[model samples]
Target: MIKIGTIELDGRAVLAPMAGVTDRAYREICAGFGASYVVSEMVSSKALQFNDKKTGFLMDLGEAERPAGIQLFGDDPAVMAQAAKKAMAYRPDAIDINMGCPVPKVAGNGSGSALMKTPSLCGEIVAAVKEAVPVPVTVKIRKGWDKTSVNAVEIAKICEAAGADAIAVHGRTRDQMYEPPADWEIIRQVKEAVTIPVMGNGDVYTVQDAVRLLNETGCDLVMIGRGALGNPWIFQQINAYLTDSCRILPSPGLYERMSVMVKHIQRLCAYKDERHGMREARKHVGWYLKGMRGAAEFRRRAGTLETMDDLALLVRDIVAANSVAEEAGR
Candidate 1:
């Protein structure tokens, strides 16, 4: 078990927050699949401060997503604190501050990874938010602002001093974005420098990667972001792999994958309306069918889906096509 402040996770694998992807439906899916922890997408602190209804909607957590985290992003300390205070009404198990997003719009505004350039400001924000909320307060940060400014250790030290319960280190600089291989050495350094739990993220695509990260950095937990796309079963597989003497689990077959796609769409539709759900499911289905025998054509057709029936028909056609291909190979 991994403990972040008073929050005790049953496992070490966590679902990292992804905007537009880690919504209530998706968080519930990941949690049900054995993800010990899950976090909401990054919400705008300034927007929340202004009482933006949409921003408020972003913190909505499903009943099953409890022990889940809500992540907030912005540069202003006062705004972040106020947002944290407002977020408590939703009863998140913890509050995470986003300091690692590499998107230009977020970083350009001196938010996200921009906070890395100013350790003092980062500390002030953490301290303010910590005082405003009763739940555990954590921060997610990159390796640094850039190669020339590798200051995660310094910044993490400052956040710890400011009362952050935990720190998640994504092993990349803002300049690298998701390009270059993550420097796990930097994560190791941050872990060594801080007394609080360190969650390691970036480039963890498989259970082995998660295990290796824990062994390599001695981090308290592993956060999977891109790796969980279309693969919520990863959390279960990782848990089994870690505990069962490294037993290799077979990958899900076509039928199982398709069934999950349908379930995911249903959940989306239940959470949102049918129109918006189908629109969003298009991308998720594409992710689910990625690299399949006829995925390109299927995805092209999926983009035109306008209703649940359209999605069902698409899944049927894809399954039939896969069956024909399998028979031909046999």
Candidate 2:
């Protein structure tokens, strides 16, 4: 059990806050699968300050998923503080500042990873948000703007001094943009430099990788990002690997996997409306079918689906066709 401030989480596996993903339904699913903590997708402080209806929708959380952190991105100190206050109404377990997003639109505005270039401003932002919210505040950051300016250790010190409860370090530079390998040494350096708990992110694709990261970096937790896509079962896999050296179980068979996909679609459809839910489920459907037999043909057919009923039919048909082909090959 790890403690971030006064709150004690059940374990050290956390879900990274991806912008389009990590919504309420996704968070609950990850929690059910044994993730210790889940962060909300990055919400714009400007949008929250303006009371944007869409941003408010993003903050909705069911009662069961407690100890969830709400992440906010913005360059302005006052606006960020105000946004934290507004977000507190939703009863997030903590508030996280996004100093790590490398996207041009977000960084171009001096928010996200752009803050890495200004340590003083980043400290001020952290201080303001920490003062404004009664809950614990944390910051997520990349290694630095690039190789020459690799300053996560310095920035992490500033954040810690400014009263952040913990820090999450993604080892890639801003220019890397989720490419190649993550520098575990950098995460180790940050963990060594900080007094608070440090969470490591990037390239943790399998249970072995997660265990290796925790052992190598000596970080308090491992945050899984792209690794969790269409594979929420990873939490259980990692936990198993951590406890024993034995090989973990493989993912479910094709029919069972399709059942999970269908359930994900149905939950999204219920949480959001059918039209929006079906639209959003398309990318997930594609992810679920990736590398499967005849996935290209299945995806082409699935893409044409416009309603939940159509989606269910396409999935059932694909599962049935695959099962028959496997039996014939035997």
lDDT (Cα, tens digit) per residue for candidate 2, span 126-238: 99999999999999999999889999999999999999999999999999989879999999999999999999999998888998999999999999999888888888778
| Reference-based lDDT, each prediction | 0.91, 0.89
Question: lDDT for model 1, on a 0 to 1 scale?
Answer: 0.91
Model 2, residue 221: displacement in angstroms? Answer: 0.8
In Å, residue 295's CA in model 2 sits off its true spot by 1.3
Best by lDDT: 1
lDDT tens string, model 1, 178-225?
989888998999999999999999999888899899999999889999
Task: State in Å the error of residue 218, model 2.
Answer: 0.8
lDDT of 2: 0.89
Quick one: how many clashes does candidate 2 have? 0
Highest TM-score among the candidates is held by which one? 1
TM-score of each: 0.98, 0.96
Error of 2 at 263 (Å): 1.8
